[model samples]
Target: MTRSARRTRRTRRMLSVAGLGTAALLTLSACGSSDSDSDSGNDSGSASSSASADQKLTGKVTVFAAASLKESFTTLGKEFEKAHPGTEVTFNFGGSDSLAAGITGGAPADVFAAASPKTMKTVTDAGDASGDPVTFVRNQLEIATLPGNPDKVASLKDLTTNSDLKVVLCDKTVPCGGAAQKALDAGKLKLTPVSYEQDVKSALTKVELKEADAAVVYKTDVKAAGDKVEGVDFPESADAINDYPIALLKDAPNTAAAKAFIDLVRSDDGQKVLTAAGFRKP
Candidate 1:
């Protein structure tokens, strides 16, 4: 073949190859755009689900409650469940501060029933609660010791007088401990506890276990303990009372059930159960 003929044919082949390369680039660019659209659609779906979770109020109701309310609240919670057929009431009982932390850490909770208004204020301050809180019940402190009262803790003054006895108390952060401190301070008495319990239940349990001679725990807790420990009521205790407060959260998932439970607690019937367990009227 002639030289010019061969050169022309080679030039045409090179141009055809370039054209194919341009076509492949356009095809890849189109696929990339399609994938981008798919990702956007998936993100939209995920966002829709999250919005539904925030806007709808039907599922489970979570309550972060004080540890001392374990039994009475448990019974009350069961009643709440029975009253609302489609709803379930779940409880996370612990120290009020610990429960506050759990709720603040993104735990899915619907209500908070604290042993004190101070702890309930923690939630309101954080803008977690929905409305003005009301006191549901009041509880008083008492000295709980192993059955038979071997140490003879008949009076609050005796705690300071009897230095030999080992005593335990709920930490100052807890409602019961705060009440105990107030009662002691009012009496112008200063006594040291061997251990500062994290919660009232733990403080009462220490006495029940015979690990400590006595502990100032809630009267409701003493009644709940039932024979494991003997309760000693001193005169000064009449002055210091722990007020319990409860409310539905602003971000509640089951507001209907949460409000229902709150209503039940405020009802005449609910007050009966609480008063029966030694809680004072609000």
Candidate 2:
């Protein structure tokens, strides 16, 4: 064989061996890297899970409450926030029925304080409440008139006699309205208000705005109004008393905080706040 041909053949053999070595090296590197990457990914996932699990109720608490509870509950929320240094509270105050609908629709809430047991029943019936509720306070309906008894609404029947007087009451779906109905029935007086509000707070607001001469709302709600409205006591109110029920929701994220808040409410300090706001103890 010629030296040139022999050299060429030897070169080809050397190149082939080099290529095979390169390929083996690459395959071995790929195999060695798989375990490290898998372990790294698993470690990252475990860290994320541990961080989430360690998160506590020191974060946030959301409360869905009735509109009538606006003034007092705001104070209570502030006190609760102060007592729990690491926690914060956000409130959603509105009509009881609307709050119930929101809860049933999956709105996040750690606590719920309804204006009436009937409203609380809706939550319980819908399975949104975490446990059985307890009646904390009883509210009675009153005639919210002008600041000085300008109309001199002597009795429940007198309200029906004045057709020109603009009066407001809550919608039938609300607890206040239901109690008002019972009261009106007890007095044998029929009244058709100019506007049917969604809650006691709205009814009181109507009178406060001077849009109505009178409105049927809770005495506590009227008391919360300050000089904006005047509350009149009537005999019918004795017959219609609304019970307010409060509870923690089943999906509460801050369950420990929620229970603590509830306990605070049932405590003497909480009762003092409610009573000061004109809510009668149960």
Candidate 3:
């Protein structure tokens, strides 16, 4: 072969190799672009999902509840927090009347659960409730005494006629107190309490702490107190069955969460918890 021909052949082979390298580079670049687009698409999908989830109900919800509801509602609140991440439930438990007064007086609360419809009516009548309150449970009055009933108190008559027995009662302004008054009236009995407590829990606490020999309180309260107090059922108690009502406040800071909490309370699971706590079905 001529020297020039050999050089031409080498040049052709070099050009062929350079063309192959360019094609290889272009193929790698195309693969990289495809991978980049795929990753971008995946990232976009993930972001969309996160945004949708973020749109759900989130934030703090404040609940004003009756003292009798402390145990069951607290459990429901915890379950709510677990079911809806990033949400918190804060509760203020006290006498239904006082809570109603607070709401009517412009207290900032998302929800209200009153032990009686009358107390709830105080809120609804004052236009503090967003809608008509619904009754969720009923509670009956019972005599709570120190464990073992050492006072030998059996009925409402014993509370009225026995002066030596130290007895405590809820204030007439609260639901439990009102119920006690009704029961006493039904029995045509009048008893003077050593002290009038503001709420059923306080009255029960007096019995639990041995401050009082007996207290007129709700059956649920006595059950909650467990061994701390013994419960005595009187026939006159049938005259006063308190209905518990709940509603969303008109000026709820977290309406979504408040509604959700109410729904959970009315759900089957919530009913189970309340019934287990000794509250009767409404």
Candidate 4:
């Protein structure tokens, strides 16, 4: 072959090799871009799922509630747990004043439900509540008596006059006791109880257990006691009505779950439960 022809052939071969290399580089770049796009799409989907999971309520919610709310709140708590599959609800039921004391004293409770605004104020005053307390229900005082009117007790006056009948009253510190005192004062009646119980439930229990002939308690408590005790509605009881308030604590461990639980309590379903238990709507 001629020298010019040989050089031309070499040049043509070199050009073809360079073209192949360029094609290979382009193909690899395209593959890398495709993989990157796929990875970004996957990352976006994973992030969306993570965000959804974060929005769901999980973990435990601790509630400090009034003793009278035991039945209704327990039912509501079970319902809340069912609604939020992974959530747990634990309750501390006691006198409103005592629960207030616990919350003000730095109790680790996510929610606080008090029998009276006065009691709720204790927590709010301490800046422990996250928001303004909302009244959910109202309760009226009633005279709880024996199954049958064995002592012929008919009214508040009857309770005060009967010297032989054993009687129980809630201590003035609790909501029920405060209401009872107001009722008694409205009627201008006075009588010493055989015992001054800490909560309305305790006062009611005394009558149910036959430890006392009669006791002043909320209508809801009397109704909850079923056949264990009888309820009497007196005219004086109308003078005092206890307003029950509830709020989320400021230092809630599970703020999301705590808010959800509070929503459940204020919902129509919650109101139904409260009314069914003889509590008046607030």
Give the alpha carbon lDDT tens digit for every residue of 16-104 in model 3: 99999999999999999998888785767577546644668799999999999999999999999998998999999999999999998
lDDT of 1 at 119: 88
Residue 109 of model 1 has an lDDT of: 89
lDDT of predicted model 3: 0.92
TM-score for candidate 4, please give it.
0.81
Error of 4 at 184 (Å): 0.4
**Residue-wise lDDT of candidate 4 within 129-169, one digit each (tens)?**
99899999999999999998688788999999879989999
* Per-candidate TM-score against the hidden true structure: 0.78, 0.78, 0.80, 0.81
lDDT of 1 by residue, 155-233 (tens): 8888889989999988998888888999998899998999998899999889888899999988899999999999999
Please, what are the lDDT tens digits per residue for candidate 2 over residues 59-152?
6888888888888888888898887778888899988888998998899899999988888888899999988998888888889998887988
Candidate 2 collision pairs: none
The CA lDDT at 107 in model 4 is 85
The RMSD of every model to the true structure, in order and in angstroms, is 15.1, 13.5, 9.8, 8.8
Give the 10-residue window scoring lowest on summed lDDT in candidate 4. 45-54
C-alpha displacement of 73 in model 1, angstroms? Answer: 0.7
Give the Cα error of residue 226 in candidate 3, in Å.
1.0
Estimate candidate 1's RMSD in Å: 15.1
Local distance difference test scores for all models: 0.86, 0.87, 0.92, 0.92
